[model samples]
Target: MNTTTSPTSTKNLVDTAAANGSFKTFGKAIERAGMSDTLRGAGPFTIFAPTDAAFDKMPAGQLENLFKPENKEELVSLLNYHVVSGRKLVADIGKWEVAKTVNGQSAPIKLADDKVRIDGALVTSADIGSTNGVLHGIDKVNIPTKQ
Candidate 1:
């Protein structure tokens, strides 16, 4: 994997997420999880990035609590829930109904006449390209595992 993980690191998770206005919350979570370097490393990734409005859905102060220094593990798991191995584009998804995430969990892929859903969130934006990965803008964050 390529190892140049800086603020402008190629097309990996970090840079791609940062470029997307919808993924601002996801990007903040990545930084809070201290996963900027790992996600920026060159390995093709498909990230189901949640919008900033999605973060707002959480209970007041809940998001801040999740980002606490002591909650890093949970934050990491949630952020990783968005990533899949390789550069999977919207067209590549086709009729596929499921994709496994980097966190060792599966997110269901739902296709509709006008849109796609990952787990429960609607994919509002699809196929944002990057050098190392692709990103889809999701309306909500998926739970990594069982609650």
Candidate 2:
């Protein structure tokens, strides 16, 4: 998987994630949740996006259910939980005790031994720069409330 994106790339966050090919399921989720335009828009945003393998770690049937039209709001909330308002690279994120997600909930940030965990999901790759913001690849999907 491509871990770092060129800081000079003109592509926006959505496009950068798409180009990496590690975020297929996440890309679909963003599109299905109707958050594509926002993530692609101007102004910077920080994303702790789960890799496709991370989506595979979800409970059976839950991933499928999240994509249903009736569950759009839930999907949106879940997706929003992976994002913050500013461009926080790993270094910037490490300085914060907690991050306020787009979902309006705070996610605990833990940094130790040169590794970072956001809301319990370990960051596999970080500081992938893009035109709109940065994207960090995470190992698991983080639920708003631990379940």
Candidate 3:
């Protein structure tokens, strides 16, 4: 008898986002923030990934300035603001008014009319599963304010 074990599926959050195509700008930001590896790790993270068009919604020169090499720390913090430490699907998030982020701050969540909002960005899609976590596509990039 011959038996073969199928390869274990292991596409993580970063891989999922990169494969989706709509998240190209967000993927680049993840690279600039040096967070590609972290998002690929285990332990279940929930990321609010903004699409390329969302990044374009920023004020003139803002996204460009944030992407500069000198602003890596700021870029990282901003990116982290969109990430929560656990897998929070739409149903799971329905109970939350605020979700703690990896950045050491909390992001306000608003749920109404079957819509979910994180900080001020509307969640355009939700519960994109990965080996390491889940992702929600947002229409705008969320910026964290100093608390």
Q: Which candidate is the best by TM-score?
A: 2
Candidate 2 at residue 50, lDDT?
100
Expressed as tens digits, the lDDT of each residue in 16-104 for candidate 1 is 77775667778888888988887787777778888898778777987898889998888888878888998777766647788888888
lDDT of 2: 0.91
lDDT of 2 by residue, 1-147 (tens): 345557898999899899989999999999999999999999599999999999999999998999999999999999999999988878778788899999999999998887889999988989899999999999999988721
- List lDDT for all candidates, in order: 0.76, 0.91, 0.84
Error of 1 at 117 (Å): 0.4
Model 2 weakest 10-residue run by lDDT = 1-10
The runs of at least 3 residues in candidate 3 whose Cα sits more than 4 Å from the true structure, single-residue gaps closed, are 1-9
lDDT of 3 by residue, 1-147 (tens): 111211243678998899878999999999988998889987689899998999999999988888899999999999999899887787778679998999999989898887888888888877877888888889998888962
- CA RMSD per model (angstroms): 5.6, 2.0, 6.7
Sort the candidates on TM-score, descending order.
Answer: 2, 3, 1
Worst 10 residues of 3 by lDDT: 1-10
Q: What is the lDDT of residue 86 in candidate 2?
A: 84
